[model samples]
Target chain A: MTLGLLVEEAGLFSTVQDLGRQGFQSLGVPPSGALDPVALRLANLVVGNPPGCAGLEMCRLGATLRVTVPSLRVALAGAPPTGDLPVLRSLTLREGEVLRIGRVAGGAAYLAVEGGFDLKPVLGSLSTYARALIGGFEGRRLEPGDVLPLLRHTASSRRERALPHPLPAERDRPLRVVLGPQADHFTEEAFDALLGEGFTVTAEADRIGLRLSGPRLAHAGPPEIASDGNATGAVQVPGSGQPIVLLPDRHTVGGYPKIATVITADLARLGQSLPGTVLRFEAVAPEQARIALRRQEAEIAALAARLHET
Target chain B: MCAQPAAPPALLHDPPRLLLLGDAALTVEFAAAWSPEAAARVRRLAARVAVLAAAEEGIREYVPTLRSVTIHVDPSRLSLRRLQAMLRDLPEGAEATAGEATEWCLPVRYGGEQGPDLPEIASTLGMAEDEVAELHTAGHYEAAAVGGYPGFAYLTGVDGRLALPRRASPRLSVPEGSVAVANGFTGVYPATAPGGWHLLGRTPVPLFAPDRPGRPALVMPGDTVRFRAISPEEFEGLWSAFRDGRADPVTACRAP
Candidate 1:
């Protein structure tokens, strides 16, 4: 049985994403995936789908999807809905039903279906990289008339469930980071300025990166480095001295000096921060960062196990 | 009668430095300056690491740049310290054998609407437009790095006389297949997007094809590339054939 949804009003910007395309960065391809992996996983879990299944990632302004089949199972995760619509819970929509997701409280939101989207994977991934105009639904944002095909779900997969707790939202907190391979490029004052509070996310922020504006970081040497491989969450300080936090859709390599990299555990929080949000940074040791990531993974595993038991 | 001249003491002027990029990635840098010696070391190390990664279970991916290699790993499966130790212990001076390099000849249409900046670039370099194209096509370049955009390659080997800084103001959108140069490196725009490099020509060959399985990029790091000038009519013919699967943009050359 085939399931589908027709786009009625595609909000700000929404696209289908998975865990990102891997093993391709060596060829200059960016891993364009959901900004918040935890949210995407949670949404999929609630809908009885695998954690890495493709789902819809909507930006601040939400979208409206019309169910075309007799019934469909879906769940929302990440941002809280502004209206009274239930989120972080699995719900079934009948044929001819309309599901409206209002403006999100955070930077983005994820909507997952029980059987996931039935789109062919491009380059081994269903994630969309709009910059290169490849992957996803037509390799671009969702349009009003686009019809997204959904894989048919088994009867056992269509049960209703709600998250034990509300999914965490992007909060006003210090984003923890690890001083980087080029930390020595910046002066002591610059380091202090970066760690201190005051940087505000600029409007230019997108899936590619979040540009921060504040004190200009002073460079001990030239700000340019030989072009090198870049990682997600790398806080790159270019010649202008402003810092740009690389994201999932960031270029495979860059030439600017990266003073620090935001720890993996905090990337979701960073992903949820909207434009104009004031943020600060705290440096941690590489060992500590590893421990934090392990802890996060353990927590997610425990959550999944508990849900299964329930 | 001759003992291979003591294999000219392996170029050790620049030692590789290993640095932690983050908790999950490590970068092995060979040298700050771009040179044949540095490029060789990078390729050698990358090859060694690829073998090591195949034997190990933790390495997720490895990307080789101009003079360095970045290795990504799963922090949960492997410790950063352990990976670093393994990299440090890799036997050095494993030169990349000559048999590994592949040569490709890319057909380009120089000047006209396809390359609007050709005249400006030629005038700036104090050379005629045809001379600029000839100089560009004459050199043999190595794909030092890939990334800036998907399938975008950074090729080294442009003559020093033709080297020029990037345009002060970048173009909002450069058409795909446009051959451009900047800061001693020549590259082709894999897709239409904003770029700061000076355009000298256009190629009918598609640099990137996500639809292709296995190797999506036509040009990969470490491959050798040469440009052959073609007329606009020839470009159209080749491009149509490529699109229709009647021709290949690249043809294999005899092993050098």
Candidate 2:
């Protein structure tokens, strides 16, 4: 039997997101997806779906889900929607049921699919960040009483399957960054100052970017740079005298001075950090960053492969 | 036939180059300076590149920004070096022919509660509020891009007279459909969110609605926009009509 959960009491910022919708940024759309890719992958893994399967990314306050399927294996990760602490709660969902999650303690939660959620993949992806208004539930956040039509799967689930172990959450620290092609845009001391100091993640943070409140880093001169392409980790410093770390939903180009970019491997870590979670920056070379990312990707692939086999 | 490594390197005019940003992405650089010619080239290259990347697996996503295109591929099925090789085979430095775009006459209600900063903006420009509204609606603007926020179209070609700096402190929430101007540009807020741009008026027309047939974002890149001033009474009538599902926006526009 195959079925999907009906969303009841959709929490603060719940949306159906996947790895991210790519290839549309050039059209001026940001790739809004799961903030914590690893957790999203694991959640999908637990449900015996592909790592890139579409799932719900519940932020701050989690929502209540009524399982419409007779039997389904569901796993919880990240800060449980609301007041639901200690991510990694696994349970067998009964047909015509309700699961209420509390305010997330750390970041966001990932709910995976068994054979992958049977949602229409727009441009080959299913993560809904709602900023671009493209993927998941018609390019908007999940709402109360929304019916999620599940994708049917041939693989039968073995009852009482052991829940996957929890991943060690990296918290409240300086995020590591790699030096950029434009590191010369800032003074030597300013570049160095980024690594040594602590920055408070401001309340102004969102899927588009995370603004930091800290000591002003001095630029070489008047900081009006030409608009250029940006990536997820790029740390852009605009005229406001504050540094903002671009995220998945960030704009494709900007005129701000990008001091550094967080490594791809550490991006998932930065995503899950709660607002007010103090973060610092550590500079790394591009090669080192790539190697680190490759290792993480390999681990994720292995986990995905194992879960899918079951 | 695949071009050989023996092929002589083309002299870098605008220096068509591909840079590996991370493990899963690469950026095709167009130009260092911002110009129409460069922007046109970017649009062309981005369109072509998107076509090429569309069928290519392992290449998860590709987005075209203002001046560059970002390609996001799966590292497991593809590698940074291999993706670079594929791009090298692509024709670079290609020119683009400009195309005609759709035009819209966005109706807005200026001043009073709808536009909170209309008086302040008018005071700053040494003009009456009505004069400012008149100037804003007179210009036919180009939709440079549909980013910054979803369904938010950054319109260009606003007259310099109406240009003003962004507010020192952005309001916590600028009402949806608020027509705003900052730094010589004007855009309408599709949804309510924090904003710094100076408000001029509000439109009842929905710029972004997920439930709509188009699924949010009424305007796309390469579209044209013209604002029309309306009275508060007219605004209320239109607002209620749309709210009650009586208004059907005439979208007689498309990318040409």
Off by over 4 Å in 1: A1-3, A153-158, A167-170, A308-310, B1-14, B92-100, B250-256
Residue B169 displacement in candidate 2 (angstroms): 4.1
User: What lDDT is obtained when candidate 1 is compared to the true structure?
Assistant: 0.84
DockQ of each: 0.72, 0.25
lDDT per residue for candidate 2 within A195-226, as digits (tens), equals 88888888887777889988787778767665
Write candidate 2's Cα lDDT for B183-216 as tens digits.
7779999888899999989998888754465434
Q: What tens-digit string does per-residue lDDT give for candidate 1 at A110-209?
A: 9998788889999989999987777889899999988888776332433588777643443766888889878878999999999885799999999999
True contacts kept of 2: 0.32
What TM-score does each of the candidates earn?
A: 0.93, 0.76
Q: What is the C-alpha lDDT of each candidate?
A: 0.84, 0.72
Which has the greatest TM-score?
A: 1
Clashes of each: 0, 19
Residue B103's C-alpha lDDT in candidate 2?
73
